[model samples]
Target: DQQVKQNSPSLSVQEGRISILNCDYTNSMFDYFLWYKKYPAEGPTFLISISSIKDKNEDGRFTVFLNKSAKHLSLHIVPSQPGDSAVYFCAASRTMEYGNKLVFGAGTILRVKS
Candidate 1:
């Protein structure tokens, strides 16, 4: 079965603190990893991504690290802001899938206290 798992359903933190979300995968064939963020009724927006060729990737306030041997990945947000309170989904795919189809986790809801 090709699936990604996010064990935590939610996380809460005060602003200006660090937030970490974890994910695990069962498929060793997966080569592409992504983190998506969503608000209310809106669709997920890509926050950051990494290729299996690399161990880590970073964006402005976000970072994603992939550990191929462990079949795990994580997203880190530093100095978390109130606006970061939302649902975060960890997604992964196999490159052979062609169009980068995503297998998303149930999503972790983050609450950033002001």
Candidate 2:
């Protein structure tokens, strides 16, 4: 079973509007949460990330929030543009002795309508 899940498979927002992408995880041991954006025929690129200890993290127009108590996380993009359209994947991981055990959600397709 998938430990990480994105409840919504797709989201559409008008350009210059706020786009909020949500994710949830069943694993409580996860210490990190990350958001990745993938474009057509391109590799997924890291967007924003938040540590479980912190409630929120912001980078440019992108912000990530983590709610450990709820086992949930979200990415918010302000004034979303056409260029922001892509598939977003939420990931969670915990550090182990050997490495990190990362689990990814199915992904949410974001369409920014201009």
Candidate 3:
């Protein structure tokens, strides 16, 4: 079974609107959550992240929320622009003896229309 899941395969939004992407996890050992955005033919770029200790974290137009109790997280983008369109992946990681190991959910494609 996958530890992390993104039920929605895709999302679409109008310019200047808000885009919400949801994720769920089955692992309670995960302490860090991250969101990454990827353009076609390129690697994913880190977007926003939230620790289990905090409920939310925001940076400019991007925000990430974590609900530790529910094992859920979401990414919100305000004033979505066409350039914001990309595949978003949610990743969870836990610190191990060697290093941090990450588990990524299937990406959700976001299409921001003009």
Please give the CA lDDT of all the candidate structures.
0.92, 0.92, 0.94
Q: Stretches of candidate 2 above 4 Å error?
A: none
Residues 21-104 of candidate 3 have per-residue lDDT tens digits of 999999898889999999999999999888889999999999999999999999999989999999999999986531457789
Identify the leading candidate in terms of lDDT: 3
Q: Write the per-residue lDDT of candidate 2 for residues 10-52, one digit (tens) a residue.
A: 9999999999999999988888889999999999998888888
Q: Candidate 1, residues 1-114: lDDT per residue as tens digits?
A: 538999999999999999999999998888899999999989999899999999999888898999998999999999899999999999988877756888899999999999
lDDT (C-alpha) at residue 18 in model 3: 99
Worst 10 residues of 1 by lDDT: 93-102
Highest TM-score model number? 3
Clashing pairs in 2: none
Off by more than 4 A, model 1: none
Q: Which stretches of candidate 3 lie over 4 Å from their true place?
A: 96-98
Ranking of models by lDDT:
3, 1, 2
- Model 1 lDDT, full chain set: 0.92
